[model samples]
Target: MMRSSPFLRGTALAVSLVLSAPAMAGGYAKSPPAQQSNEESRHRTLTNSPSYVPIAALTATVQANHRARGLLQIEAGLEVPDAQLRRRVERYMPRLRNAWVTALSVYAGVNYRYGDIPDADRIAEVLQEATDMTLGEEGAQILIGMIIIHGD
Candidate 1:
């Protein structure tokens, strides 16, 4: 009879244990998790710890009709630390929106092609720049709520 090495036996045991872990835990259930209420979801997302000021929804027309492809719509908000800065942001909303539109339009015209999804982070950065330039300050954080690209 040949004796198996202790190291080999230990390795095999470890592998078996790892493989059987899920079975030991009674396996997976068929049903998914219970859904939370819309109000609860919103409350979780919108925390009292930060001041969130709404930005007007913006629609950017990407490249001209390649069958209405590349049209982008963005809805966002700004999180400013204080009420005063929030007010300032509100006052400069028009300028900020214009800057964002110009930047996003140019970006889409150059970078967006057919069947391509726009990068939300990149667009958020662009919006942040516009906000900072308009406010003459840098603490505002851009929270993008929605980015819809109408592409075929």
Candidate 2:
């Protein structure tokens, strides 16, 4: 019978320990519980938690981005004929929409936090200018189909 090298034995033991540790610890039992039903769990967590706010805001922003993306897709479908142009437009659409929505959402959320609507509008105007410059006229027009212009 061949003798195993000390180094190999040590490596094998280490690997064994790592592989078996979780099983020995009662794997499933160590895991967290499943979330409760929607209605029952609705008020269980703190509403004002910073961690929760960002997640909720991110979700809402993502939804808004999806809407913007849909609008862009529609516009691209109407405007572009060739497959290559359509594909390129589709690929860029999500990034454009997400950037715009995230900027708008952040501005609005910060303004709401401070109870300052006018300032938020001003900031939004600046954001819009930036977006328009970045996106150009055609891109701006596509985005406009999704977002409502509040003032002018």
Candidate 3:
């Protein structure tokens, strides 16, 4: 039988250990190199910049156990593509508010509790739908700046 030299055995073990170690660098990037500020992102939505129409804050009652549990407050803006569309929306403001309030009230009754605002995306989608229905097509969007639900 041949005996292996200690130096050779030690060299083999070292090589194996080095090869088995984890790599220190280089796979895939985990995220983007640059990130936008929230304000910048908000200002840069797809709608035209000068066409935001403000909606008054709306208060709707949410009930539980036949008692008023909370007030849901939503403040939003409509984004239209041009001054003409903006005027059309403004001319029909009463109808739009009525539709928005009704939509929000139904949403609050269905999906929210005393102190929770439903998902932002869900709210945005509902608002967009309401706008589309009111305007007879999909030409405008709703930009919801704040939504708050607080216990009574």
In order, candidate lDDTs are 0.76, 0.41, 0.77
Over the stretch 1-152, how does candidate 3's per-residue lDDT look in tens digits?
99999999999999987876644223232334444354345443334568877777766788887788888888778878777888899999999888888988887888666555468788788778888899887777888878787776
Q: Per-residue lDDT tens digits of candidate 2, residues 1-152?
A: 99999999999999999999989888655445544355345433333432221111111221232232111111111233345544554556655556555655655444432222234344445445544554443333221212222321
In terms of lDDT, model 3 sits at 0.77
- The regions of model 1 sitting more than 4 angstroms off are 1-50, 64-68
Q: For candidate 1, lDDT tens digit of each residue in 59-127? A: 777765554565788877778888888778778888888888987787687766656778888898788
TM-score of each: 0.62, 0.26, 0.64
The predicted structure with the larger lDDT, 1 or 3, is 3
Going through the candidates in the order shown, the clash numbers are 0, 0, 0
User: Who is ahead in lDDT, 2 or 3?
Assistant: 3
Better of 1 and 2 by lDDT: 1
Clashing pairs in 3: none
| Better structure of 2 and 3 per TM-score | 3
Q: State the weakest 10-residue window (summed lDDT) of model 2.
A: 69-78
For residue 12, model 3's alpha carbon misses the true position, in angstroms, by 99
The Cα error of candidate 2 at residue 9, in Å, is 53
User: Model 2 off-target regions past 4 Å?
Assistant: 1-91, 113-127, 136-139, 142-152
